[model samples]
Target: MIAADSVTVYRGLEIGAAKPSAAERARVPHHLLDVADPAHAFTAGDFTRLARPLVEGLQAEGKVPILCGGSGFYLRALLRGMASGEENQVEAAAIKASLEARGAAEGFAGMYAELVRQDQGSVSTVHPNDHYRIVRALQAMALHGRPWSELNKEARATPPAFPGLRFFSLEVEKEELKEYSRWLSGDQVQLTIHLDKEAFISLSELRAIRSRTPGTKTFGGLIASLIELGMEEWSLSNRTATSLPKPQRDKNFSL
Candidate 1:
């Protein structure tokens, strides 16, 4: 499992970022967590550069890689290649610099308020705690002064890294993570989630939930169970992951 979260990528932000616990990582063998310093911000392009190869490797091993996180921007970049050709790339870089400067000056809370003013639909689409997705959406919206709802869901995407790699997009409807995971378990389902402000869960809550779910000792195990219905779901037997045919479409709730 490769985390697509921007904050979780930092080394010392475990609690705030709701990073997978040490025990959870021990159980699931996750990649790309705690790989950056908190002083520096991790971008969606960086996620794609790192995660694309990791997912490819997992596919080569004949095991489907599960992307578990709340950062829709990073997830979309990983699933659909991040490059948008030369001209778009140049524009993206300029936008990135501008947004980074804004974020640095205004702070996430201020930027988030600005985002709320611009796009309520977008504000409702992503998890409230997903800082990267919120700021990144602002960046994209800035490109043409368009609200997120009016912009194309696909953002300058190219080819996906893993072609013929089907995606299983599931929406866990419950708002709270604790209730949501249990609900999914009771129903015996694995799904991705689209949550707004109240839906975001804290680290302590997630840790408590992990302890309650049998055999889930770490973040990897807990998330794995919630997102894929236990390791048995990945058993060589079931290959029918329901979703779009175009290799992980629906950017909002995709892995």
Candidate 2:
């Protein structure tokens, strides 16, 4: 398994990052953990450079590499290569710090608004709450003297490092799943659903209700509605499961 997480990428951040324990690593071979020093900033480009070869080597050995992490940008870079040009990491860091300072002084909303004005296309692709990517996009545009969206377009045109790759998104709520679905563009992407029988039944009922609703003609609209219903049911089930009272321990019992 490859740990493509940005937080886990740095050394000496195990406790705060909540990285897998030593025992867990011993049980399963893991890569890309503690590969960089905390002092050095790790970029998606750097991650792609390192992980691509490991993934290929694993594939040659007839092993499917499991990429486990929440670093979406890094994962995207691994799957689809980054744009040409060696991004000046030092300059990018300075720019990011400046932007962050401004965000702190003013507000992140203002920073995000400025980014939208600078690169509307790229801003649309990223979530509003994602401050890291927002600042990064602005930094890239400033350094390269081009739009982040254009760079991404160029990157997409380049042949992927791992061809015929499939993506399976595991989301707790369907709304989250639907948002991820937007990230899947080409035929190479596929959705894999794993749910309990009760959840599956709930999803089926939601689908039926969505089918009967008017103005749910478009595929996107239907998907959004079904996901909304599914999330409601999932949340209710989760609450019910967790709300159960824990069994009281015997007063005389001791560890």
Q: Please, what is the TM-score per model?
A: 0.47, 0.58
The sequence of per-residue lDDT tens digits that candidate 2 reaches over residues 1-255 is: 999887677655444356899999999999999887654457788898899899999999999999988777788687766653577777877987787667658877877788778888976566677666676777788889898888878877766667777777775888876665555433111321322232233333332212222221233354557789999999999999999999898999989
The clash count for each model shown is: 4, 0
The weakest ten consecutive residues by lDDT in model 2 span 187-196
Instruction: State how far residue 178 of model 2 sits from its true place (Å).
Output: 17
Judging by TM-score against the true structure, name the best candidate.
Answer: 2
Model 2 residue runs over 4 Å out of place are 60-63, 83-85, 174-255
In model 1, pairs of residues that clash are 23-218, 24-218, 24-219, 170-192
Q: How many backbone clashes does candidate 2 have?
A: 0
lDDT of 1 by residue, 1-255 (tens): 888765677665444366788899889998888787543446677778788789878888988788887676677667664423113656766786677567657777777777778888776665555555565577777666777645534443346656676566666655676786676576432222332221234433333223222322344354545546645667534455543355756668855
Candidate whose lDDT is highest: 2
Q: Give the lowest summed-lDDT range of ten residues in model 1.
A: 189-198
